[model samples]
Target: MTCPKPRLQALLSAWNAPQRSNAGFSRVPSTLRKLHGTAKCAEEAIDTSTRRHKVIFSGIQPTGIPHLGNYFGALANWVKLQRNAAPEDELLFSVVGWHALTLPQDPKALQQARMDMMALLLAVGIDPKRSIVFHQDHIQNHTELAWILSCITPTGKLRRMTTWKTRLAVSRNANDESEVDDSLLNTGLFTYPVLQAADILAYKATHVPVGDDQQQHLELTRDIAEGFNRAYKTPSRLFPLPEYMTTPSKRILSLKDPSAKMSKSAVDPNSRIVLTDTPAQIKSKIRGATTDSIQGITYDPVARPGTSNLLSILAACTDDDVLEVAKRYHNRNHGDLKADVTEVVEETFRKPRAEFERLRGETEYLTQIAEEGAAKARSRSDATLREVRHRVGLA
Candidate 1:
């Protein structure tokens, strides 16, 4: 399965070749110095020659405003990755509009949410000049690749996916899939992982940072890649089976219900702390956060999920160990802990929230960023898609 030249090699070649006269087309820098300053570029974590290139790809749904869970779960990690990424590495952070369509969305609201997500991403330290940041649907190649890959994906494999079941249950407010009828499920919801696979594979991504829950989808991506290689009979595999770069499993639980993960879709507005929440709002939510009436603090998630959740938030905000934070509060009461957590949460979100407010009003700048990012993304992905089409006998 002889694959076409790796995406990075193609990009580097373009970088070195003479500049193109095409409007809006310019060579991307071949070094990390272009993204970050020379002094700030950290020593490459992986040997570049052995690795060739690390294509870091990840995306988030632009369903609505991101919350504390979104920040910590994905956004914060993205910033860290961008900071550490090498010059040769390509980092693609997408506002995945296609994935958001698995569930119903208001068109006008969805359009605005996409813009809001881009502003928040920039405000939170995602450097568009350094990384490719754009809306997923802007590139037609993603869904196009998904359809191609779907030919090799078995219906049974898609049915085995657990997320669809959960989405169905959530749609009807049921406790589990058992309560929701299968007839109501949509094809997009059932095969969401295929599109997710397309998102990663389209870039020929080499590494993806994902939490435990998302691990399953990445595995399925690998399966699809392998299946495609086998079916095509390519001398070298066309798609590189991407590997997971496991991040700290920091699952931010819902403020209202500690048993559940924090989510934008939760019915209760107070269930999560959104990036736009004011300091007063953060304080109010923390103050009302459900904690046990026990006299003292302890870090037992199963026994006292509410209090443990607060301690977890405090530790995450302060970069301290949760157990250590809990030990400090051993002598204090729930109110003291909540107060401290509130202070930390407010302080953590203060700058980003302000920056978001400022960026939101800059419509011209946001549009330029999106247009430039989409161009870069398309340039790379379109090449891969063309190779894919030719190999599959479409071209």
Candidate 2:
């Protein structure tokens, strides 16, 4: 029996769909015979199995001039990544000024700090041409995308974040979480991870170079991407799952308290080495650094943290292995090791310090570079925002 004309057309349309695209025409129902025979051969392509050099996205807060920990842990890796980047590779290095504002900050000081940070990044070899280096606030899309991601993110996840908990413990005089009311813990601090995820996904970054401490946040970024993709059911992956690129260096420890990481927030100024430290300041800090009355120097982080910390710093600065550095000072006393580490640090920071001084003097040039970088960043971010908006039905 012959099928009705309308039924035939319906069958034809169904047969033309992708599910039946691969079926042999002879086996297709007669109603879809004409449609099946007219189909083009499926594109035969080889799965090259080569991995794409993923886009790398990393950011630093515009707190102040970066300390030695910041230099060795993050900025140094950023320079190496950018220098070796392929033509197709994408890299974004942002000065996260908004993230800096989660805590109370003086307006004028924050502004100055942001400008100083941009110059320092340039002096440290973050080429604006190779990587998109800009202030986070300049690209409004970051906040816009962050708001959207926050909507879909579970409150439990934010509440469980280690960073907020650590900050609260250090800042609050009260013992329990209830003592510090919601006012003290602002929405910005609580939802900062979502914003961080937005920063990566906004650029569709596929690889992130971060310290072990930041691996948790990168995992959160992946979850956000997967959740958004599953929710929207997009044809293609909306965001690439970012992989972490870790450096071999262990966390740089404080000079004053070798147990703790070198941090800008340390109560003692001598605890951490600032990138802009003068030769005199470096010498004084090294001279006064806390070290036990140990007879010999060896790399023992657990037993003699002070000497070990110095050795680690030396190894990082000179790009030598820690074990090898320890062997160099195998039977030496603490004084010899400390003096050697101090010298290496001074020599390593010398060129960057000079560049920073030159860049700081040329304020006009620095301003121009920041503006140009911000403009380029904004253009790329705007495109991503448009696609995201369309996906979420905002468009």
Best by TM-score: 1
Question: What is the overall TM-score of model 1 with all chains considered together?
Answer: 0.86
Counting clashing residue pairs in each candidate, in order, gives: 6, 0
Model 1 spans with C-alpha error above 4 angstroms: 1-49
Error of 2 at 172 (Å): 5.9
Local distance difference test scores for all models? 0.80, 0.76
Per-residue error for 70 in candidate 2, Å, reads: 0.7
TM-score of every candidate relative to the true structure: 0.86, 0.84
Every model: Cα RMSD to truth: 13.2, 19.1
| lDDT against true structure, model 2 | 0.76
lDDT of 1: 0.80
